[model samples]
Target: MTTVATSSPVSGARRQAAEGTLGGAPLGPAERAARGKAARARAPRRTHAEYEPAPNRADPIDVIDRQSRSRLPELVPLRYQRMTESPFRFYRGAAAIMAADLAGTPTSGIDVQLCGDAHLLNFRLLGSPERRLVFDINDFDETLPGPWEWDVKRFATSLAIAARANGFGPSQRREIVATAVSAYRTWMHRFATMTNLDVWYAHVDVDEVASRLADVLGGRGSRRLSRATSRARSRDRLRAFTKLTEVVGGERRFASDPPLLIPIDELHTGRERELLMGWLGSIVGRYSDTLSTDRRWLLAQYRLVDFARKVVGVGSVGTRCWVALLLGRDDGDPLLLQIKEAGTSVLADHLPGSEYGNQGERVVAGQRLIQASSDIFLGWQRVEGLDGQRRDFYVRQLQDWKGIADTERMNADDLTLFGRLCAATLARAHARSGDRIAIAAYLGASATFDQAVARFAEAYADQNEADHAALVEAVRTGRVSANEP
Candidate 1:
């Protein structure tokens, strides 16, 4: 309901403060940052070292159960299975669990468009519009405006958990956490000095990342990065077309793979498929309106040929996700769009409701606001389910040169570099949505905040391991059934 004049430095800084507070209303970015820096005396940076869970903390399994009630029942076991893969994997799927815990952590009251699930694996390589490979936050499923430290803490904890799973020594894991926090803090400071446009335009190019790593790691790391970058470049629409579809009766259709990838025609009876296709067709029309005029025109060229259900991600396995296969010009020219169900973000329970009534619109809007370059075809619509209940869904290119880090294969040096890269990328994302000057000043030039967060990360990783163990125990005792595959 409140709006700030972004054009004026002093008014913008004043507006950055919480509503009903006139504390430093006449200041500029620098002064606001200085005020935030002075705030350390009251909410000391060292306070982040504490990581005790609340005495009344909700049971992790109970929280998981609550979320499961909204997802597809049949695919629930798959979500459990992926989560049971390792402590790191469980940590990846436990954002809701972390959200519950984070509600009780020390917060600076500075809000930002948080990645909400800012784990290390979430930061990866993707192709920018110029076809240049860049590294940025690749998932915004749980994005919302919330305290900045929550994102930082979640990221740091993930680094710690991942390092432990990778068999790193205690000191090595601590170093990774330290490196990550230092990178986030240092980058925020850099962003604080930059003009608005400069911050907006900044991105972490993978080639530059590789070059920087090359100086520190010599040929091996650089070669590994080069391979990853090359692999990402190759995973465009053509690659998806070749791998996910096949010609059937003179028409290209999605190949069926049971329990993971199922063509809609195969999953439902003929009459049911007919009814579903009609709804899907109408949904596409609605979703198209969410795009820009040029993009909608570009999408209008592609004729929908077929669609299939898809199981994706450890945390997202139980959600309704479908891939629509479209033919643009001919059999060789194709575009695959993923229509994924969107629900309330984990942060929504703690923060204000989204301005958009549709959850799909929330995801689409948050992605556009935070991502450096979003999918051109990204859009959303509301569709009625088989049960006759309407659900929100967002659509985007299924695989537009997206790549994820193989955290399982990373060594200590590789992991630390990864931590720094992810941390820096997160800082850039926060700078885009929050008061970077204040965040930077709160972080300060010294290593106090970094050190405190490193300690917190180490402690929270222990809690995550224990929570993961509880899930494993539930599976073992037949309290929760799961498939290992």
Candidate 2:
């Protein structure tokens, strides 16, 4: 595998600021606030409530089919099947569809390192490098610089859809959605008043958050939170090692699981397998070069034992994903790493392309920029696949102390509180990369923007349902194929 060149799209002035060498004096708080106020005049906050589909809107199925063309043919059916499970499921996999819709929405001309697919599920519990559990945005697949409103709108819409799935009434759904937007608005304003270093250091500690919410959660919610945290802590590297690997002929290797976890040895034979393993080994070596000096030394201690092409997530099912098993010292010491394919950002069509030439680099850059903490092994590399095509891929631990919300079991009260937490986390992420003061200024002290976004969330949830029905009809009429597991 050959190495790919890296480059950024940021201009000299912006790059200087990013590198801690401001080209000139930065804008004062008052000037930044004025700029935000001017943007409000250009795109009134009330206008954000509107969400009528364009007369010339493209067919949603066509959009799905277009994305499928670049994915593995056999697994495309599986992706459709997952999406067909429910409207919320469809929304999870329809980032590209939403990116197009968000392009026509109102914005405050504010750009940030967006968590392109900032749905409610994407905000979750993660283990920081310091071994502390923190609530933060986890997915960076569709990340790019774009309007801040796009992320807010996608997140709010997800709450609306999820609330609907939980059998919430219209008033309940409205309150849930509004809670999230209000949290984002209020937190952004709070960040605006702090020093840049203080804002940068801000993060929500899971333990502290749970303790504070004890009274609000009462009996059932508190128990649920306790269970989730316990489950997350148990999902360490050793746990994944035991679950995914087994000894065969006195050798540790990945177990055979068709279409999901097919071992590399199973896919090729004899000399071909030898060559494939050597190629993958080289790719791993190249990826290590992207890490810092100390991390590179740490990674060098582990020897690659085996690898498998594994399927993962809703939209990522058809993309090439591999789970590499490495042994550090003995059979008990293992490190599981997931190497996932990175494609063009969904927002690329509607906004400026990333500065980074390699898509994998783009993902890594965005993650490092916004996440309060990141995986030590995180890195990216470009590799030539067996198909003779080069693809970009990012690597990270397969499982850390990761926990996702159980939205299915949540009540209206649970959802409202959970949505607020997600919104606050998202705001912290945005403040790390965007103009917090300007954004807070545009939102103002009123609930106008919050109420407007809640309205948009409901309307867009309606649009999402229609789009989901279109996909279901397509599958029924043989326009699309769906494979049930």
Candidate 3:
């Protein structure tokens, strides 16, 4: 995380008007990156409609085996080797693999674009210098449109995974899953009353979120809530950036490092930088409206201050990611953008629909449609590899005051409240896409799905444990490698 400029109370009126109402701007490479401070995005985006599917083996699992074998992407086999360690551990990862598998699964008649990995751990609070704590879904690499059930099932399964990771027993996990399902059901019932603007305006702040969690979990769970929130606040972008990087001369920049945030000076010496820059520029034009209108304004306003290739998330471990530091207005006015490679969605293999112009754009669009409110600058792009390979991407601020209370750290009471809030929030998201009246009808009066999900969760926990053991074995045999960074 790097320091971000604190926003003044710029009218929500103007910001809202700027969305949809404002025309997009195109920016040339020289103008946008005079100092190269923003997230680099010079790649061509291939919407699903344009995608030429790579050949896969007769069996889909073979796809992972074949792809992982090539080591074309960062450490895929190693990631699975790590996932094999525990279903609970692996459950945190069900997003990617499940998405891969889901893309290949038989589907229901009903579908809406989805956040393929809508798990419990994905929600968090991002803070500003003004100390405003806003909670929202933080990851979109696996975003896609698919069966609505996929999102709900994924969210349900995540509750099970988090409970197991928290060291809760079978009975405990079941109860938590039920809590989540029921909360979702109840919340959707109320969403019908929310005005369009209200839905867009709805967001949870840290203090308010914590108090709600405290009411539900109580005792041990409540205590855990406090701990998780404290840890989250400490994860400030500037603070994390300082710990991970070093200052060279007068610049607040990163030290020379391998596979982490690397300095441009070190990169320009190698041909990869030029290739990357070209692709980044293309991605910008395809994904960002700024390329058309604000490119010159942005170019004159900011310079690239720093960048790095970062590894993030349990599932996103091996993917390519870069974080750019921008100095705007002056050195103190800063913004951090994370430019990550958006591979095909996990759900693409299962319930594929819509030939999107760009998968990354699909993600950005789905997120905005589903979320009550989205990052002001959220956008996507296509990046072309020198090898004629290309990947799509959606970009945004890395973390303003983002925080999540991990399930493992919660007390029972906090867990209950956390469960409710997450459940309700998820329902709100779903309502944004599909008809709530129908979904509410489908969930009418009974806790059957809640109960069914709980049962499925207990069974899945057993599977997770077995898988975790397999990963541990792989690590011992040198079949895969794992590292913190």
Index of the highest-lDDT prediction: 2
Provide TM-scores for the models.
0.94, 0.96, 0.76
Off by over 4 Å in 1: 1-26
- What is each predicted model's overall lDDT from 0 to 1? 0.84, 0.88, 0.59
Once fitted onto the true fold, the runs of candidate 3 whose alpha carbons sit more than 4 angstroms away are 1-63, 66-85, 100-108, 127-131, 193-197, 210-234, 256-260, 264-300, 473-485
Judged by lDDT relative to the true structure, which candidate is superior, 1 or 2?
A: 2
**lDDT string, candidate 1, 351-437, tens digits:** 776666788877877787678888888888888887889999999889988888998899998898888888888999888877788
Cα error, residue 140 of model 1, in Å, equals 0.8
Write the residue-wise lDDT of candidate 2 on 1-485 in tens digits. 22333344344544432322334656778877777788899889999999999888889999989999999998999999999999999999999999999999988877878899999899888888899988899999999888899999999999999999999999889988988899999999998888889888999898998899899989888889889988898888989888888898999999888888899988998999998888788778899888877888889999999989999989788998889999998988899999999999999999987788889989998898888989999999898887799999999999999999989989888899999999988998888887887888999999999999999999999999999999999999999999975
Q: Backbone clashes in each candidate structure, one number apiece?
A: 0, 1, 57
lDDT of 3 by residue, 1-485 (tens): 12222232112332222121223443332332221222112111111012112265133233335435433354565466556655655666555445553343323333444667887777666553346666666666666555566676677777777777677787887788888888887886676456546655666666786676565555765666566677777776566565656667877775666554566556675677766665655554344553324433453466666666665666765666667666677655666677777666656666544355666666666776666556655666676766777766777767655676656667555566677777877777766655454455445566765776566555545544555665566656765655432
